[model samples]
Target: IQAFATLFQYGTFDRFPNLKFVVLESQAGWLGYLLDRMDAVFKGPMGATTDMKELPSTYFRRQCWISADPDERALANIIDYVGADRFFWASDYPHPDHTGDYIEALAELVAPLPSDTRHKILCGNVAGVYGLG
Candidate 1:
């Protein structure tokens, strides 16, 4: 599993530099685990040989976004760790697993964040990523 994780991490980003990837429904807590391992690999001998200019976590920090259901407590706890800029709130509406009234829930969840951060996550971030504006 360890080897596979390492290889998969490198391969995914390597193959898709322009890909605006978002991990949907994957709880945000796992992102910290992935980042830690990727950072470790970057500092180790394996990193020196890679074609990537920056550490894998660096790539993730800049290029990746993740969606979490509004009600996911684990996601709430880890939001700061992953950087709020890279997170998008998802209603997963009509899906049984998603909480109803996700917009309201998201508003509440992000209320304490800086206004700029809240504005970005609530709308501007997705718009920028998807080229909507």
Candidate 2:
């Protein structure tokens, strides 16, 4: 797990620069802490030194997406840091971990956001990310 974490921290999604990675079934609460730790480590002597032009979090914020299981508060906090463009809604339907009513749950989760942001989380963002549009 630690090794994968390190890889995730240092790896670049260069093969899919235009692609957005949506991490499903992973809780949103840890993202901020992880990003913070990654940034700290990158700036520290113990971390990898690469030719990348930005912080690790900046890369993640640019290329990653995540799904939360109705954990709106935690998700909202992450969005505040990474911006709403980096997240999307998932029903995880027929999966025991998610609320069965995925669409409604997404609606509720995005209720407080502006229309554009909600649109991104619900459809627009995923469409663009997956090249489905």
Candidate 3:
């Protein structure tokens, strides 16, 4: 959260708009709150503290992506609100702490989402983030 906030606060994205910032191996449920807080700060009196020309969330939606843990169920509910194109699935495959079969869990978690949102989270977003065709 700190790094995410700081980058926006420092106008990092403003200077390098095309840079892709991917939050990996991290649960994505906190993005909504962070976006809200950052936007609030940007619009508040402290807004002048940063040289940015856009809201923090605006930069986020344009230049950032979050890797959602396959088991994070709450995230599915907020994907559309947070921008379905801003997310991608990450299983942390082969990591010892991430043991057990999570494919079924991933499938069930994403099953409730709309088809396009599900497709973006599962495949399209990653390609978009990395500039793949």
Cα lDDT tens digits, model 2, 1-133, are 2542554544545544665566777667788888888788778875556544567787787877776666556676678888888877766667776656766776678888888877887788788788897
Question: Against the true structure, candidate 1 has what lDDT?
Answer: 0.72
Cα misplacement distance, residue 93 of candidate 2 (Å) = 1.6
Give model 2's clash tally: 0
Candidate 2: residue 57 lDDT (0-100): 82
> In model 3, which runs have C-alpha deviations exceeding 4 angstroms?
none
Ranking by TM-score: 3, 2, 1
lDDT for 91 in candidate 3 is 86
In model 3, residue pairs whose N, Cα or C atoms come closer than 3 Å (at least 3 residues apart or on different chains), thus clashing, are none
lDDT tens readout by residue for model 1, 1-133: 3543554445666777777776776556577887788789878998776666677777777778877667766654566777777887777778887657776888777777788877777787788889999
The predicted structure with the larger TM-score, 2 or 3, is 3
Regarding lDDT, does 1 or 2 come out ahead?
1
lDDT value for candidate 2? 0.71
Off by over 4 Å in 2: 1-4, 14-20, 48-53
lDDT, ranked from best to worst: 3, 1, 2
Residue-wise C-alpha lDDT for candidate 3, range 1-133, written one tens digit per residue: 7877889888899899779999987788888888988899889999998988999888988988898886787886667667888998988787787657778878877888889988898889988777787
